[model samples]
Target: MTAFIFNNLNDMQANINRNKLFVASCLSLLVTSLSFGIRAGILGTLGTQFNLSASELASIAATAFWGFPLAVVIGGMVVDAIGMKKLLVIAFLFHLAGIVLTIFAGGFWTLFLSTLLIGIANGTVEAACNPLVATLYPDNKTTKLNHFHLWFPGGIFIGTLIVFLFEKMGIGWQIQVAIMLIPTVIYGYLFSKLDFPVTERVASGVSTAEMYKSVGTPLFVFMFICMFGTAITELFTGQWVGVLLNNVTDNAILILTITTGVMVVGRGLAEPIVHRFSPQGVLLISAILAAIGIYMMSTVTGSMLYFAALIFGIGVCYFWPTMLGFVAENIPKSGALGLNLMGGAGMFAVSIYTLFMGGFYDRLIAEKLPEGASMEAYRTAAAGTTEAAKYAEAQLTAGPDVLKATAIIPVILTVAFAGLVFYMRNKKKPQLAGA
Candidate 1:
């Protein structure tokens, strides 16, 4: 283990074949990115079928986030000890099982468990492959990482559209979920034939103790703390959009489409945007735009609100992958451990918020409806109503308030991230000058 850890990094780096690595990395990313969209689309379909109470549905969505922290921790050792090829195989199998379980998940526990498993797989994918991308292009970490992540939002766009197709065909949600396994199976085959990078932990010869210490800096902590916020902003919006728009319209599908469309646009543009400003500058800007857009999403109404959703999407576009890319670029020597920590922190942040806020947002949104009104009634009443209609002649209204109230989190997150970017910048300046 020590020899593997202390191996000459420069020599080992030369052994890395860039073309095979890129193809394998992109394939891995395609699976990881596509999985998120599948989860989102499946949950959305579940919402329509189950007619779950706002909190109940939100709880299911939150299940996926729970696996984030643990996956990162496990991935750190797994990638270095076992290698990326094996880890990718493990991720694919776990993801395939999660999809299968979701297809058969009948009741609340089953659905929640399946989603949780999927989240775990997703978390592992991020933990292992994110670092792999960094290792594959150590000299161009941010640019390559951003390009690798383009598929995340891009995958969501495809998944979203796929759901629209499935729904139109009156196919069961289970069938739609099962369809994801096709890609998982195919990617497993592709990855099996390829060589992957040894984790930085193994390749760099860094001691575990030193590995932990190096990343324990204030800058790393501060950056991840902000990343936590970005994770919440990204996951929360995708998770809650169906419920958020429930009272606004019966067309849950349409609402999801619009929201996800914004996500696609934002993510598709992420690489260029990161190149233009550096990941840090782009991130700060993302935070500010996300805050304002979330505020508008919550408070505003009509065609105007749709525009706000787009803005919110733009803000979140580069947030998640960019943060991962930043750490990957800056801390190439830490290898999987460093990358896993970032992924873990981000996912853990999402899980915490989802678990707590699922119920909280439900109560907050419910509080605005007329007293004694059932959620069904409130949803029914709010459909087709303007913001003014929400206030006057309220049979039971919930649209504007829920969307608006949810903004509170993003607003707080944006402020916190702004400070984080400032600190990271100052810390890096000294280091760069010293170098």
Candidate 2:
């Protein structure tokens, strides 16, 4: 009778600890999304204040992407060795320092380095939390991962609102940057008190050699390539909303807010959708919608932009988490390293594509100007009264063109995911037939 009571107490305590760990993971991811939201809000401000070109602004933004892949790949490799708790501790320290450095940043390099630190922190969050969630809910990996990742878009929704309201109140960007510290501190505190579990691979007794071998499978390779497209389709567009849609909308950042808002809702209700269609089917459908939405966004204007953004939000809402979930389900042997590598690959692709988009935007702007007009001359004229309208018109043209080109990425993904869906269905058919 005493042993039974003790066992029940132990079970209760374990459940309580699991809940705390999950909550802490969510808060840590919240910091990452908040940073994304706030950075999107401040991109234009940074450009203007620092007298930066589009490419330079992109370089600054792309630094985070570079740092993200670096940290996630390394953290993924070592997570089993050093554990999730230590990775998160590193995240907390980097986040704290990054926020402070960004707040006091005077120029481009400071901004670049600070954002890199924050990016490392963001990657570390995924490195720890994704595997942690997969381990915690082994039977329900896809559904639970979607639930865990909902906080990403949810946090962005909250962060955008914070930026919007604070901007209305005439607050500076530094304050907006600093506000991220609240959730950071909370997650840090929570993690400090909680005990972490071993990664799913460890708990399941998958050998390290087997884990490495599994990631090289043909399907895993295909998925790794697909991650590049899906990530750029979602993240590149989300991050560039300020610049891409600035001329078309009065408050372009609201487009990000609205998009993320839809994402939060979609991810919140993902269980039913994922179960009904299966992850592969959902990926195919999401790819189709994302293609159409990006194309529509390029062509649409005014209030119609909101509707296009809604379609896009729904399209990308399931993308990141579902991709990770698919691997966790299909490539269980690949384990935490596979999950981290998938994420890292996506960010690495985005970093390269971000630079391309920035350069593309600038090139388009240059082409739209008078035959011999220099960007420097145009900037000088626009600052005064004479060419401001012309500059605006050029942005109006260039921005949509950029979106039009980006639309091609999702179109390719649609074809790829359709193939994936078909392959997965057929792959299951033989077993069913034999059974």
Candidate 3:
């Protein structure tokens, strides 16, 4: 069977209703905002109670990423069998459970468990919602996707404010985590009442066998590989920024605000950029630039480090949603399952890297310490150390291997992602061959 493609304007416009699509877009933003708010927002505030060691804290921060792959995969199947609306309900419940668990969590294991569950819920939101949004507004997939993605940064913007408010009020992290539920509840209500379109792949009446067959094509595999790398970049950056900064200096809380602020501004500015470029083109630049940004970040100090983070934020801003747009643009007929599966694969990739990077970062940070040192010796070493002294010492006395390793991972992944984009650009030349 030949696959369907929406290359014409009329066909695309006929596929969606403008007003209903706006409502759906708003829902996507809500999902992005809340998802990130919990993921990154919790890190700055919640760290006080959890008191996770640098590495343990990294794992908790990255745990949500781990659930991404599995949830996306399962969500794909669920969206296909049931519907996007039902999956949203399930996602909401999981999020609620995870948040509640976070409030009562007593130890590393409980917190880890909560982070994992929350990650699962967050993954569900991406898996179900991304495809639904594309279907709701098929006429301008790339532009619309960018608009939908605005909420991710937008949510982070709101989340940052909440973090500030809580800190000012002297309220604990648990309350901050709990407070996110208000948006979730409000969005859940709105999403429940709206009627979403059937997924594009299904609505096109593409058969299951045909859809399954499409996966065997080289193009799908290429996109999947790019997705894996993209996931690692998007997740580990946000998840570990606080830990990395904390590892280097005592003013981690202040640095986190700066990093999140940079991210919000970068993402806010991305809306206009998306209109002028192809999604794949946008991703190609982001991957390469991110590599340079991370490399610079590992080496810089003082105000330079802050500037590098801003640069890094700009590089990574378009990654997550643009990757989805790549799929929606190239694989217009790929129903809910297709989008969900891509999300699942990407997330699963991130989970692996998150665990690996967390362990790697922790082990390396630990190795920086001189061997056989007692608590007394370590405390003495820490005593009277100026904030700059700690970071400078950490930068020097700390082995260069781990810092080098961090840059190497993303650089290698960026090369691979670039290759995938090249493959995708050429793949369309012989599109009928896949059939």
Candidate 4:
């Protein structure tokens, strides 16, 4: 789809309720991100409470990631045709169901299903709002998308505070998950009356076949693979923060707060950075910084971990939004399908790595344990006893092992993004055949 240039108001005026749309869109992503934060905080709780192994727990987390790609890719395909309103409503219903099911979760399978539902809802919100935001502020796609995405880390900051507060008060984790509903409901209500502009794809009258044609190219396929590494590197590490540090320090949530807080601030300041580095240049540097940050985080304890988390947070801050923004800017013909697929690939890839990292920890933890240590006995052992204590020791070592393994993803990404930067710069911007 050729971008609809709003050279004359009579041609295509974008004078909708932008402030309300922005607020609703931020809040939409807020609930999605809030689930991530709350999930991170409760990971250890779920692990011990349900006697789940590292792999089992990660499988449950994987369910959350697994549901995202389907919803995002499918919703992206029809978001323009069906209107943003229906997708937002679907998201609201799924969020409500997912939250309730999670609170009443009986065990691993129940939690998995609940989280899967919530992930679908989260994907739907992204599918709808990303295109909506781009349409609303066409002239400032990167900056506006960054601001819209700031709520992701902003919501993490809020959820982390709630987790810390609730833990201090002896409140149940269910209440923490439920607390996300406040913003969920607010966004749902705000969107009820809001009018969403058609996506640029629809406005420019791009056919579905044309959208496929653009997205099916080798360049788009390569980007799909690159986004996978980018998402897993940012997401799985963030998701595992609480579990990784729980055995190392009582201050796990504090570390989460620090990292997410840095992300929020970094995104708020992204406007000037986008001006300085351009999105592709910034992404190349981000991959480099993320690789160093994860490697430095191998300590998993000590005061320096906080500093490392800050570096990691700033490194990943621009990745998600700018990746999408690049498509909006450079691959305009791919339309909403390309945007959603990029995100879908990222989320889908993270789900796979969540499971992969879990299995890695399981293997590493086993190697460190006594030769005859029975896994089931360790699971059932009383909190202060020998097997239980050995398990605790295993967890501490596992945290760093997983981080060390995960650090390689960003190293690969550093190389891949460098190639992307080269591609973005040296090549003339390609025009759509019909444009």
Candidate 5:
């Protein structure tokens, strides 16, 4: 009776600790998503203040994406050796320094460096938390991971709303940047108080050699490549929402808010959907919806933009978490390194694509301009004159053209996911036959 009681008490205590750790993890992720959301909101202001070209703004934005993969991949490789607690501490410090630097930034280089710091912090959060969540709920990794990742869009919703409201209140971009410090402090405190568990791979006793070897598998390689599409289709579009949809709708930032709102709800309810469709099926369906939604966004205007954003949001809602979960479920031996590699690959691709998209948007605008006319020359022309009107119209057309080009990414994803779904179903059939 005494042993039983003691065991139950220990179990209850563990549950409490798990809940606290989970909350800390969510808060950490919230900081990451907040950075992304607020950065997206502030890009235009940064461009105007710095007098930056489209490509320059994109390069600044891309710095975060670049920094992300570097930290995450390294964090994943060393997470077991140094521990999750230490990694999160690193994240907290980076986030703090980054936010402070960004608030005091004087130009493009400062902005670039600060954004890179925040990106490193963001990557480290995923490094620790993803494996942390997987270890915490071993039996339900997919559902719980989806639940954990809800903060990505949820935090974005919160961040975008802050931007939308504060902009109306005439707040400066620095204040908006500084607001992230609140969550950063809270999460840092929470993590400092808690003890962490080993990653799922470590706990399961999977050999380090085995983990590295599994990452080189054909299936893992295939998924790694596909990650480029899914990530670009989802993150790139969201990050560029303000610029891309500026002409399509007056409420450009609001569209991001609405989309993220949809994602929050969808991710919150991921368990049932994932169970019904299987991860592969969900990926397949999500890709199709994303394709349709982006295509619609390219052509739609006004109120229809909201509807298209809804579909796009729902489509992408399942992507990041599901991809991570699928690997956790199907490629267990790949371990933390595998998980982080997947994320690293995704962000790296987005970083490259951001630069390309920015340059592409500028090129499209240039193409639409009258012969020998530069954007600078047109901007300096008198308001309401033909040159200025032509520039305005060119800017408007460029945004939609960017969207139209982006639609191709999801279309590619749709095909890739379809193949993945077929492969997974066939792979399962042989198991069922053996059973």
Candidate 6:
């Protein structure tokens, strides 16, 4: 009886652990989405309240995206040595501290600093959970990865919806921002109670030299560049959509809603498609479609904008997860650190462009607006001969050109992907000759 109960208890414990970790992973992503949604909701308010220029707001955005790479890259390097649970705990502390700081921020520098903290938390969560999920479901990496990432979009949907509801009820943006704490608290509790396992690198007894050797190769570096391009293309485009469109349409959140919804379903059903097309085929097709979709977004507006979002959503939906999945499959030796570095590369690209786009918008408007227009013409200005009005007018006109600038990124990606596909096709020729 004792032996039988012990066996049954062990089986029960095994089932409980996987499910708990999955939920914790989802909640971690949920915190990220919540932070994103709340930040988007208040972006305009922050700009007007603090008398912030477009570039200043962009700095905050840059700070947030930049923090991801710092934490993820470092977390990746140490995750195997320190274990996933400690990284997760650090993320939790950052989330708690960052959210509170963001809520109390009254100026540009303060907001930037707080957001940087949150970004660290966000990156650490992703770095730790990604390898955790991959380690748990080794053979089903792509399918499970798709499922794991589904929560990012899913949390986006929930968060944006919550803010939308609060807007209808006349709640302040601060409260909307604070609502993120609910999930943050829940995830913290779950993580506290959960037990984390060693990374696959440790379990498989892979050496430190072996891991370093794999990531140091030429092929890996080239792929890292491709990952950087693809990441910037997807992230920068999404961040700009809110800023440019918020004033143009009151229903701006709906665009985010539609795009994220499509992404959820697309990722949910990724398994069969991944099997049929192969990771390389999927990436090539994704790059092509993303270019076409981003072009349409640059050129379209109104109800038709939703259609454009759908196409763009489906195009970029697979880029993030599939990139991680490919590295996991192709470079298993590099392990969790490799995964973190790949993701960090993407976020680093995002941070750079966020700052650039921010500065670009400020400079673009300044070049046209009368010098005094910067100080006076804002929020409530009307269409007339006033300097503020002219500045406002200039901003409205500047939107399209900014988007056109973004379109260049995906075009570069399309060409890069085609070349990669060609190289992949001929990958074994040299090795075969040596044989």
Per-residue lDDT for 3-48 in model 4, tens only? 3343433144456788998999999899999999898888888887
- After TM-score superposition, the amount by which residue 84's alpha carbon in candidate 1 deviates from its true location, in angstroms, is 1.5
Compared with the true structure, what per-residue lDDT tens digits does model 1 show for residues 174-263? 776776777688778877877676664555555666667757877677776777778777767766665566455454445445655776
lDDT of 1 at 24: 58
Q: Per-residue lDDT of 132-190 in model 5, one digit per residue for the tens?
A: 89878877889999999999999989999988899999999999999999999999999
The alpha-carbon root-mean-square deviation between model 2 and the true structure, to one decimal in Å, is 4.1
For all candidates in order, the CA lDDT equals 0.67, 0.89, 0.65, 0.85, 0.89, 0.79
Best by the TM-score measure = 4
Cα RMSD (Å) per model? 4.7, 4.1, 4.7, 2.3, 3.9, 5.1
List, residue by residue over 71-131, the lDDT tens digit for candidate 3. 8788876686787778878787887788789888887899889888878887788777787
For model 2, residues 1-435, the per-residue Cα lDDT tens digits are: 545653454454464478889889999999999988889888888888887888988998898898999999999999999999999999999999999999999989999999999999999999999999998887788998999999888888888888889989999989999999999999999998888877778755578998999899999999999999999999999999878889898988898898999999999899999999999999999999988888888999888998999999999999999999999988888889999999999999999999999999999888888788778667546455556666777999899899999999988998999899888986742110001
**Whole-model lDDT, model 6:** 0.79
Stretches of candidate 4 above 4 Å error?
1-15, 430-435
> Of 1 and 2, which scores higher on TM-score?
2
Q: Please provide TM-scores, in order, for all candidate models, with all chains considered together.
A: 0.84, 0.94, 0.83, 0.95, 0.94, 0.90
- What local lDDT score does residue 25 receive in model 2, on the 0 to 100 scale? 92
Clashing pairs in 5: none
Point out the higher-scoring one by TM-score: 1 or 6: 6
Cα misplacement distance, residue 253 of candidate 3 (Å): 4.9
- Which stretches of candidate 6 lie above 4 Å from their native place? 1-16, 370-385, 425-435
For model 1 the local lDDT of residue 373 reads 51
